[model samples]
Target: MGHVMQVYLGDKAQLEGVIGSKDEALLSRLLDAAATEDAVDPKIFRAIIDGGPFDEDDADEYTAAMYSICSILGGQSIDSVVFHFRSCPDIADIFYDWAFEDLLPPPEGSGCAIWTKENNAEELAERTADTGTDVNDGGEGDEVDDEIHWMNESLLAGKDLIFFWGV
Candidate 1:
């Protein structure tokens, strides 16, 4: 059988399905190119954006489109893609559920672990503490308030990137 090529936006909803080895190679190459540079080429980006069939009610299609864009822009693949815009605390819990409930299996590894933000934050926080949260906490010689403000601003500016993947 010939190679089958499926294009998905962000969710698994298929945008275009083509049959040909060459087409499959081209698509894979495009994805690789986008993933490498942390940016998608305008031509490829426009192609994906314009190629989908119009379906206003299709949430899956829109989600898939976002994923396609992310994939093109170096986003990794997880079983499900959960988007958290504008930084909410619940975002971490959402990711936790995705990992433990959807992706991770029991100790025997019966199921796959999905990606979520909870796990990421927990890990990040732990690492931050381990690496020394003291840098943010003012020492006796430095101004504590200024240090706190600077840390807060830095964290706010360092927003998490919108994509992740598990191999």
Candidate 2:
């Protein structure tokens, strides 16, 4: 299976905040598209979402739709390509936490870690691994703390489309 990246918009606060009318509308569209039986490209899908305003409900929808898409594509055995806006550090943390906790597996060579400007790859990797969670990038480039090395390799291979907005 080809590598797939799951991009989520909005921060922790925005995700938990009240839903907005515009965001609700966009999310409805995303859900509709994500539920389709046809193959979905992360690039095209993210473009559609990025074309409009996203809110907390949008975040939830993105998360749910991502899981659904993964299941449709096959299962968690495949690696995920993730991108998110880094508007708030807390939000970034929340996104990472959610990604690590819910979406991505515990490194285990099944997951990848793509950080935004707000994320400290080293620190996040260490903390994530310390929590008894397997993570890739734990110490240095060659360490291979966990199975997450695939993610680092992806980054080195020039997967630039995936990013965490540092704004």
Candidate 3:
């Protein structure tokens, strides 16, 4: 596959299986157009009103994250989650453990993808090129990792969560 994205609306039960996806009809419809035009559908307002599958509420922040993800696909930005681990091995370790090794018990209702099972080789290679990292690896990954960590953390903590990912 050239490039693909698989978004999740809930937690990985054991680094593999996930709960059902509730908002694909909403997110997929929005991103399908946003991918090309770098614009967001008005439906985003509704998604914001409904609150996140997680707890992130500010539509502007989520919008920035969403468009930033689009920027990565267009080569205008480095992949956020990918560069996070490449630069800050320590912080990356915390996130990575949650991603794979299960360092923290995943939040109960958090929407997250099981990268090992879901990511194709092309995406994996891109994520862990292991060559070099952005000058501000810690800073760069902070946004992406924070989005993911707390979403999962909320689930583990039994709080509202959201669906978030990028290719």
Candidate 4:
């Protein structure tokens, strides 16, 4: 399947208004600015929330950019981050290669993943493998799965959230 992206303000239920509205212009620019890092930048200048799950097979510049946004906002204690794609460079590099792809999905059969700074490279790979099966399954978990829903600073900062969805 090809890639698709959608933005949101607060809840997934509100995604319809954004998918084709003027916000698409900002979504396009966010996709471009998000590419600034091969690794995600966690400042979350504009907080974001997940609107939908990305199909792993459709990993492309847009999805990678979404992943970048999530990775950064998912934590408050992380020092650095990395994504272990079986053969691709880190997410930072993926962001720089802004384009579409047919088969380059993230490792662990994950449509997208965010490895915190805590784990070593090997540990990160293992964690990715483990979380791929459990985290994305739509059940309660140790962490919030972006595949289902992701949150950012918008709620706390009182800024109107710009949520996102991928397809």
Which candidate achieves the best TM-score against the true structure? Answer: 2
Q: List the candidate 2 regions with Cα displacement exceeding 4 Å.
A: 1-55, 64-143, 160-167
Steric clashes per prediction:
15, 6, 9, 4
lDDT of 2 by residue, 1-167 (tens): 23234432223222222223234454555557656745343433453235323333334334443444333333323233343334333323433433424322223212222333234345546655675444443564445432234334333343211222211
Name the better of 1 and 2 by lDDT: 2
Task: Give candidate 4's total backbone clashes.
Answer: 4
Q: Which runs of model 4 end up more than 4 angstroms from their true locations?
A: 1-10, 14-18, 22-25, 38-62, 69-108, 112-167
Candidate 1 C-alpha lDDT tens digits along 1-167:
12111211132122122211135455666667667666444343333344433233442233333345445544333224333334434333433322222111212211122222343345546655665444454355444332233333334344222322221
TM-scores, each model vs. reference:
0.25, 0.27, 0.21, 0.24
User: Can you rank all candidates by TM-score, best first?
Assistant: 2, 1, 4, 3
Error of 4 at 109 (Å): 3.8
Ten-residue region with minimum lDDT total, candidate 4: 94-103
Error of 4 at 25 (Å): 4.3
Which window of ten consecutive residues has the lowest lDDT sum in model 2? 158-167
> Which of the two candidates, 2 or 4, achieves a greater TM-score against the reference?
2
**lDDT by residue for model 4 over 1-167, one digit each (tens)?**
32322323232223223322335455555556666744433222122223223344333333444444333333232112233434333332323322222223332222332222222234434655775634344455566433222223223322222322232
Q: How far out, in Å, is residue 39 in model 3?
A: 13
Extract clashing residue pairs from model 3: 10-111, 53-161, 53-162, 54-161, 54-162, 107-155, 107-156, 108-155, 108-156
